[model samples]
Target: MDEVSPEETPSQKVPPWLFRAILTGAVALGGLYVLGWLIAELKMLIVIVLVSFFLSFALEPAVNRMERLGIRRGVGTGIMFLALLAAVGLFLWAIGTVLADQIGDFADDAPGYINDIEDWLEDTFDIEVDAQGLLDEFQEGGAVANLATRLADNLINLGATVLQVLFQILTIALFTFYLVAEGPKLRRNICSLLPAERQRQVLSIWNLAIDKTGGYIYSRLILAVISFLAHWLVFWLVGAPFPVPMAMWVGLISQFVPVIGTYIAGALPVIIGLLDQPSTGLAMLIAIVVYQQVENYLLQPKVTAHTMEIHVTVAFGSVIVGSLLLGAVGAVLALPAAATIQAFLASYLERHEVVQELEDAEAAQHPEREPLGDRLRQMLDRVFTPK
Candidate 1:
């Protein structure tokens, strides 16, 4: 027989299941890519929602109190918003007034300031310098002209930015209002989708978030007040101009803003101090540094422990992590978010008493140190007890 040609080898075929699996995996990967893109596009919207959600939680306690007093939730929310706006308006007015007055005073006394500076330079550095000549040269050298030109060029941009900020604020307000006013209904609808156990867990988490956010807000307010008082006293003693506004600026910015806020808040006062007198600036700087140390080491830990039930170190680390992830908003929200997480974890995680040997080993490592609980209690006692 002629060399039988082997039957043409049939091509190996992929199993149907394997082909389907590959197709499914490709689609899944494509879907994931699309999802990531969408998330990137909506990042700002997501952040706005988060901020509004937390704001609603922070205001819920006050709204509930108002509801108990026979106020409708809508009315209470509106009232709260109105009050917030009024407070903001009042602050702006006060700050504007202070600044305008200072500017006017400085204008009137410019010549005197120049003379004083000249005398100081002469006395301190023995440099016979004509300060007025330098001032004239500065005005004539096109520096001031360039500054004005730049401001003029960017005026439209500035205006647009302001409008954008206002729009965002309005959006946040609307979201917050709805969340607060319909909080109960929202909770009910959420619970409707879950089983009884899950509903309880959801509700518990909601309540926990509210408590933590509210606690964070209240504690920060308390700290702000303390900062204001301390700075106001220091400013007055040092005869710094606009002491009230300066103190308010420091207090609110330092307490409410996160990360670099303290530096920003302290800058204006120090700058003004330097302009008025170097010695005054030095004093203010020293006071600010001392106050920060005291707050960081003493006041912050105690207050946060009682209110947020968070350790300072954990709060700080959260802030850093939050800032890395979401910038300023993350930093601002870090404390409450951390507190809620910690509380939730504490409830779910099982606990066991430490073994005696481990305790003994720890004690041995720090033989002279008291138990952490005891040390904290003693510190609190010292702080709160009257002389």
Candidate 2:
């Protein structure tokens, strides 16, 4: 190696403090980037934990009832968990079986259904259309084949996603058990984390969250039951095929999906009916529309009011936002979130003196601000005295 000149030496090239400062900045940036990624990746787990906590709270009433009947807390909790698991398993099996059968039937009759739809569209719109030509074009090119291949690939991907979800669900269940088991201690620990003055406020907020979540869950359960019965009766009376399974699916999915739930619930039955007969499809569609109106106008407000009194607009907006962010899980979560936010805002407005005074003044004078006492006195004096 050649000897370096003193001026060109690496040790003389940079200040130690400057180099250290640059290194520190780079390391800090890297650390922060890594932390952000970790948080994003772990968001799903955080959601799962939150959901589990809400479920645990919702089941508290039942657990307490069991305790009152002389069951131990642990035993009652175990029974509740088991019952939940069994119900879920049964529901999944039913839905899976129905969906599989329906998919197979749909596949078998797809060509005929396509032709029927094209004919109906042409007749209804008074426009001639060629269904066979379209099908031929689709088949002649590689597009149809590629689409089928992609569909198969998508099915595999869906299966993998389902398996992953199942794994996550098991993990959630395990975490939920621990959360429920140590609920009291966990609450105490949470309270301890705050200053003495803040502890009470924190505890009160916790209780409110629990109460709202529990009420929402209970209300949803009741709504699901009522929807199932209503749909079942309607479908049976209308002579719809697969009435029971369709009704059950409608009820369960509607409970989870908000606003457009009824529309989505009706899609399957209408499609199946169209495959068989146009008149029957129309009848089924009418039945769905009527039932949805009844539910929306009458049942929903009454049922929800009894639980958590969230406004319809708020509920709709929350579900839309939540679904945009987190899909089905978010939709399920949105109701409680809206209720909680509404409660907080209401409480805040109630506690604020300025807000209270403004509200009172507004009530007394429509679309006008009343004068303050001092201003009113000054006005009165000006009017009485020669100004």
* Top-scoring candidate (TM-score): 1
lDDT of 1 by residue, 1-387 (tens): 666454766657777799889999999999999999998999888889999999999999999999999999999999988988896797788678877776666655666777887999899999897777745533534453256677889999999999999999999999999999999999999999999999999999999999999999988988999999999999999898788888888888899887788999898789778778899999999999999999888988788877787776897899999888788999998889999999999988999999999999998997887889999999999999999
On the 0 to 100 scale, the lDDT of residue 23 in model 1 is 90
**Model 1 steric clash pairs:** none
- lDDT tens digits, residue span 53-170, model 2: 7777777777778888999878888998999989778778877787788776765566676687798998899767777775663453545536667788799788999999998898
Ten residues in sequence with the least summed lDDT for candidate 2:
136-145
**Candidate 1: minimum summed lDDT over ten consecutive residues — where?**
137-146
Local distance difference test, per candidate? 0.88, 0.79
Among these predictions, the greatest lDDT belongs to 1
- Tell me how far candidate 2 lies from the true structure as C-alpha RMSD in angstroms: 11.1
What is the Cα-based lDDT of residue 304 in candidate 1? Answer: 80
